[model samples]
Target chain A: MNPPLLDVRGLTLRYETDAGLVTATSRVSFQVNRSDRYVLLGPSGCGKSTLLKAVGGYLAPAEGQILLKGAPIRKPGPDRMMVFQEFDQLLPWCTVTQNVTFALTASGRLKAAEAEERARHYIAKVGLARFADRFPHTLSGGMKQRVAIARGMAMEPDILLMDEPYAALDALTRRSMQDELLQLWEEIRFTVLFVTHSIPEAIKLGTRILLLTPHPGRVKAEHRSDGTDPAGPDGELLSERIHRELFSDAREEEAGHV
Target chain B: MSDSGTVRLPLPAARTGAAPAQRRRVWRNSPLLRKACILLVLACVWQIYAVQLDKPLLFPTLTDTLQALWSSLASGALFTRIGFTLRTLLMGYAAGILLAGVVTALAVGSRLGNDLLETFTAMFNPLPAIALLPLSLLWFGLGNGSLIFVLVHSVLWPTALSTHAGFRAVSPTLRMVGRNYGLTGLRLVLRILVPAAFPSILTGLKNGWAFAWRTLIAAELVFGVSSGAGGLGWFIYENKNQLEIPSVFAGLLTVILIGLFVENLIFRTIERRTVRRWGMQA
Candidate 1:
């Protein structure tokens, strides 16, 4: 409607490895509106993470451009924050509060006192206020992810890029985190580009799902789940249906490639 | 998907106290303490033999050494020599550490710089700092400058090597996380790289200080001209020339005491504050 918040057009990525020039993704395009929860769903080596990296301006595309609020994404900026998959995403040397404050300070967004207050606010929001003085090494995997999420949200980025942020968590923790994330999204309404291979995660979280094909990854399909069901009892059924569809689509894509 | 969703089994709580208790029992029964006791017994035996031999010039008894140490402390000669040695050691150690950091930063920041550091360290690391005494004397003249020059040489390479290795070993994911936050150049290194590589860097600093201490003593012994008057090494050399064996032993004891102070106090405190607290090292 108003020139979507992010516009990625015909994006292609190739990596020069010791083996050969490998095409990671090809002609992949997507658009995300403001406050959209968009998920990129694909199998391993489908270049979903690469696509997320491209959006964050960490990786350059072989072809095509990513525009954020009409400005071409050239390099990484504070405007696009990332929650990495690794538990060590939070710097070990820094306490939770310091980790969040680092972003605010580094970006020159606020003075020390104000930055610290803002950091506390985000840490409290992520339910880690009690652990503010604790370093990352002392945190559990889920707790570390929460710190990462809090740090990202504290930056007040236009878009939050999560690269399979919950992939490292235990099953129960992953479900709890997903629920918490949805609750946080409802409150904040921040735009999110989440990458996950898990179909349940995509269906549960994404307003729109971009299904990608493996190796030289391309957009296989796009599913708008907002109208179907909004993660209730019926939502579980819809998730199952979507899961089957993704597998069949994946199999078909594999057959076509072979 | 089923396998992916399978419940993750929780690992048992790590047995933190058991190992220590077992280690304590073994240590109580082991030859380590017994050997130490035996060594103490041998030292007493040697002291008794020296006293029986009545050889003050050739071999000072333990009591004689203690008396010499006490007299030196009372006269303030021991304190003066210790102060001089500490000043030179600290100056050389600090300079060497700073130079190592600069070199490591340059090495990590660029490919050409990395090549230069590797080549230079390879060329110089093998040459013992003592061997450079003659060249250092020629360059800086016979003074504290020459001693400092050798100390710098001794401290720099080991620190640089360990630091470089630490920098190289930093996890890629951590590096990416730093980059994602738009950190680069000096800020990136100071904030992320240094802290992440702290355990190795601390190890390097400890080794560098030890080397600097040894080099300072050796250099001072060779060039005992009392450049800033005299250090502990020069004191020992002077006492030895005068056949003052007890005073030489006192000077040696002072060196040992200082080494113990630095290792157990300064470096131990640093390790406790950083690596141990961060859970990077035990």
Candidate 2:
């Protein structure tokens, strides 16, 4: 069998805070195959975002290593484009189209005209074609994030690293955005390493979900989905089983639960 | 029982989301009108004081000062001197701003650059520009050179200090975003730090302009003719010596007017276009 698209082994991450060395993750391991909708789901402060950031090449592993294809991950490159949670991630000075084109032109991957053409294509895909010339500040929060995701997708990276891209939106917008993302994924078949705390989102989006334990995050379990239905009768049953494993806190309960 | 006697009241049209109220104010809404009233009051105070003194040599009357101002306007010599003073100030201000840019660029580029900026500003920011006049005269001789030298010193430190502070204030996420796209060195500084910290940088430019203006006037007053001619400062000095007290007052008034015009017109317009539009400042 071909090696997984991304191989992470015995990875550890820590922060040197003013008070002490805070361990965020300890010897966690996982693998992602090509075109896989891999979801890293856990509660807040569970080091899930930190783990994704490590894969994005922003943070280094303290112990084991993350391998992409066959090479070790060292620095951030255009190969792993990121979509951050903040609305201000879009450059305020650049128009929506310019924001995406800049990433292409600045990385020396495409000429100005070509970059602009691709930028418009993605902007259209995200339903922001009319606002192509508007500055980021003029756009709403959801619109700004759309521009950010467009810029990331325009790079056509090996894998898109999304850190809770829809977490900040209102419920109605978030639901619609999630649907849009899934539809876009179906069309492109691009690999995405998605991180979120919502259980239903994992069941709906992930081809496979990796559940992590609280605090210093550790891999608890992994589950596969049918990949054909979200509202199918079987989906409800799987979501409930996954929910139980997460909130049960088996090890914590043994210590009389903090 | 209550349903038999109860009455319902209609809400105000605005409360019920009818036509919005007219966007207008009842107070003195026009800034121009308010400024005119203030000038009129100040003129009255000046007239009263001059009447009490009853002397042109010691304290010229409002009318006598106006007469001096009119004669100068007619001669055109006052305009020439004002122009010269302004030209000198502009040269120094531009140089000072350029140097500050370099200093700030260095500060953000590396640790060593930051240290140099901090060390130099600490050493010289408090040293008055007028104090350097003697040294500048000895070095540059009696021309625009000496005047400009002192003016540059006055403008440089504050500008560099403020710009460095602004660079430090740019958001970390923005910095990471720039870096992730492979931006480093000058491109990163220009595309990211400059716009992010423009509010503080503008504050620096304003401070530098004020400092340069004062330094230019003081240097010219103490040193006499520069580049073979006297500017407004020399005009004030010569008029005072000749006992043309009203003309001296007129020269001082010219200085005040120019300062006011620049602060209100040029700088305020720039502020409106940039930081205010960006919503960085109100």
Candidate 3:
């Protein structure tokens, strides 16, 4: 079998603050194959976002390593494009088209005309052709996320790393965005490493969900979800099953302590 | 269950012809129009007061100052003085900006550079630029050298300080984005940091310009009699010595007009086109 597109093994991430050292994640291991919508599902402080940042090369692993195409990751590169949740991710100075094109040109991936053409094509795919010349501040949060996604997709990176790209959107917008993302995935079948706390979002978008526990996040379980099964064994909903799997450990620990 | 009954009221009457007046109000409130009105009022008061005082030696009338300004302008003497001053100002200002750029670049680059900049700015920023006049005069021995020295002093500290503050304030996300795209060092500073910090940098430049202008005028007024090739400040001093009070007022008027031109025409236009258009500022 061909090697997985991304292989993260025993990756431990730490960051420093005014107080002291913070161990965000410890000895986490995962593999994302080509075209896999791999979701890191966890509650806040689970260090899922930090894991994503480590993959993006923004944070160094305190232990273990992240391998892309069997090569160890060193620093952030165009090969792993990131979509941040903040609307300010788009350069306020650049218009929507320019924002997408900037990534292409800045990475030296494409020439001016070709980059602009590809940027516009991706922008049209994301339904922002009308706002091609509008600044980021002018666009709504959902539209800005679309622009960010288009920028990431336009790069045709080895894997797209999204850190709650739609978590800040309204419920209606988030739903439509999920649908649009699925549609895009259908068209391109690009590999994605998505991080989110929303269970339904995990089921809806991810083909493989990696559940993580909080307080120095460790992988709890990995579930294969086609998002087609509403019910698991014993007539329980899949979301409920996943929820039980997540919190049941905490409940057991509490019972053991009692 | 609520006790209050629902009562419906008739629709309000439609407005009659207030749109034109509101539109006119918008036009009337334009910055240029309002500023012009204030200027007209101030000039009227100036004329009235000067006429009532009836002492041309102490306080000249608005017409007298204008007449003096017109005669000087026509004779082209005022132009020469203005040109000399502006030329000197530009030289010092350009040098100051270049030095500030280097200092700020260093400050952002490393801890040592940051320490150096912080220490130097703290020591010199509060000391008035004019205070350096005597020391500069002692070292450079009069003429435009000392004058330029003082001008650079005025421009450097504030420019460096504000620019450093601006660079420090650039958002981490923006910096990360720049780095994510393979941009590093000078490219990152130019493409990301500079534009992000421009509003503050512009503020610094404005402060530097004001400081440099004031310092130059004061320095020239004191000892700018260098080989009789002095600037507007020298011109004002010479006119005062000769008891040409009207001409002194004219020189002062010329200074005010130039200040207004730089602030309104140059700086305002830049602010409008860049920061305001970018929505970084309102």
Candidate 4:
């Protein structure tokens, strides 16, 4: 196959807390090709979010490396925009349009007029054209997340790093947002490194899903789906197989220990 | 997570009406109206007491004080003194705020800067501005410069301390977002920290203004010694020497009125526009 757009090899990440030297992830290896809806799937405390952060260049790897477009990932840059799970991710002081345009102008990527126009386009795309002038606090939780998504998309970065972006939303909103995101991907085919603990979300969103073990996350298995309708028979089988692989490890470990 | 059933309960009567419907409403909805009523009652009490005492010097009647206030205002003497005081206060307040801005900026930017700000504010914040008047007079020598110096001292520390606290209070998520947007150093401060921390900064400005106002008046009491003209403080002092105590009361009244005007009008308008509009303040 052609070379991947993003590559990770034997990556380990650790952080120093009050408890000292906690290993979050260990020797996690993965590669994401262009236009791949790559999902990092795991249980809670799996360090999938930490892995995504490392890929976003926000965290340094204790060992190994992350390469984006054949580059050694270093510091946070405009090329990798992040969508945090918090509703307060958008600056409250800025209107919706300003929040998106801020990223463009602040990155020195686009001028004022161009950034505003582009932001408007994405705002409209997110069905938030009317709220373009409203503050983040004025918007509902779902609407705020949409604004954040629009802001991330307006930058048109090489990749979007979304860390459980819908995990905070209510059930109905989360379902609709998943569909909205898929539609956006269908249109633009932008590369995304999505971290989530939801199996259905992974099945529904990912072209290739990386299943990770519980703590100090290590890759358990990789599964690929055609990114078609998850309600279809093919998609259902793929999801079942993924569920089996994802859970079988724990069962095997218990059996071995017993 | 399920929405499976409908449940209803009678709402509390207290929640609906607060009290019996037959009871008349005594309190006005507007705080301003309520405060005005309070002011009128206090004035009446003052009038009655002053009349019984039948002495203007010891405690001037409200009307007597108002007459003195009216006369000075009509003669333009009070206005000029106000002008001088405001000019001096503005200069000192602006200079102090600008310096605090720099100090806060430095404090947030690096380790050493933070250490320096912490040390300096801790040492100087408790030192009253009046305590520095003698030093200011000795150094700047009997003019607006001396008054301005003490005013600056009064305004700087609290402003710096509050602003620094504000900066520290900016959420890590916001800071990370700023950094992700390729913002660093001064740009990070201006765009993210300042706006997010503005409520605290505005509080700081308010505190600093009160300090500067008090310091300016007290400094003028002594500053009038050589400058030959002081602000409202000089007016009060001059009136005391002449035993025109009602005029002294008028001067004190003018000071209070001006303070009320600024606190209610200028600062309140600013707070309403920026922090309140942004939902940073209740």
Going through the candidates in order, what is chain B's TM-score?
A: 0.84, 0.86, 0.89, 0.88
**Location of the lowest summed lDDT over 10 successive residues in candidate 4 chain B:** B1-10
Writing each residue's lDDT as its tens digit, candidate 2 over A1-258 gives: 899989999999987889998788889999999999899999887799999888988788999999999899998778888888888787766789989999998877799999999999999999999999987888888998889888988999889989898889998898888888889998888999999998888877899999997778889899887543344365567777777788766555767955
A188 Cα displacement, candidate 3 (Å): 1.4
- Candidates sorted by TM-score, best first: 3, 4, 1, 2
The reply for model 2, stretches above 4 Å from the true place, is A1-3, A226-236, A250-258, B1-28, B40-54, B59-76, B110-128, B131-146
- For every model in order, the TM-score on chain A comes to 0.92, 0.93, 0.97, 0.93
Poorly placed runs, candidate 4 (over 4 Å): A226-258, B1-27, B138-141
Q: What is the per-residue lDDT of model 4 for residues B87-175, given as tens digits with 9 covering 90 to 100? A: 88999999999999999888887899999999999899889989998988789887888888898899999999999998898888888
The best candidate by lDDT is 3
Give candidate 3 misplaced runs (Cα > 4 Å): A254-258, B1-28
- Residue pairs clashing in model 1 are none
Clashing pairs in 3: none
* CA deviation > 4 Å runs, candidate 1: A226-258, B1-54, B226-228
Each prediction's TM-score versus the true structure:
0.87, 0.84, 0.93, 0.88
Could you tell me which residue pairs clash in candidate 4?
Answer: none
Tens-digit lDDT string for candidate 2 (B62-130): 788889988998999898898899888899999999999988888878899999999999999989988
